[model samples]
Target: MNTIGHTIKAARERRNLTKEELAQKLRVGTHTVEKYESGEQIPSNQTILKLSTVLDIPTSELLKKQNI
Candidate 1:
């Protein structure tokens, strides 16, 4: 998987959030979340920022970077 997908998966698992649950929280479709996890697509910038907030991590972490 890509770094972005790997990071997202790790964070989601740490938070105990299923794809459906995370999608619901993001107000996006489960397919979107699936694509993200599968590394088929990347989330939009706004979505990444929102996910970082919802997941209680910095955007850099979500981006697979050590610093934001």
Candidate 2:
């Protein structure tokens, strides 16, 4: 099952961006990116919107959830 974090990490990797690079684009720190990717945190709606734009993915993709 894919968590939102997994989806985000996959999208980021598809864009060939490192955690630091994605953080820089999102105006967040590298640790924050790690947290997001590790499913230790969730981003705000505003940040999600920014991520959609930066990652060239739909917001729906970021909002997807696992059945569990």
Point to the candidate with the largest lDDT: 2
* lDDT of predicted model 1: 0.84
Error of 2 at 33 (Å): 0.3
> lDDT for each of the candidates?
0.84, 0.92
TM-score of 1: 0.85
Best by TM-score: 2
**lDDT, candidate 2, 1-68, per-residue tens:** 78889999999999999999999999999999999899889888899999999999998989888432
lDDT of 1 by residue, 1-68 (tens): 34777878888999999999999999999999989877778888999998898888888777764222
CA shift of 24, model 1, Å: 0.3
**Candidate 2 global TM-score:** 0.93
Candidate 2, residue 17: lDDT: 99
Clash pairs (backbone) in predicted model 2: none
RMSD of 2: 2.1
Estimate candidate 2's alpha-carbon lDDT, on a 0 to 1 scale: 0.92
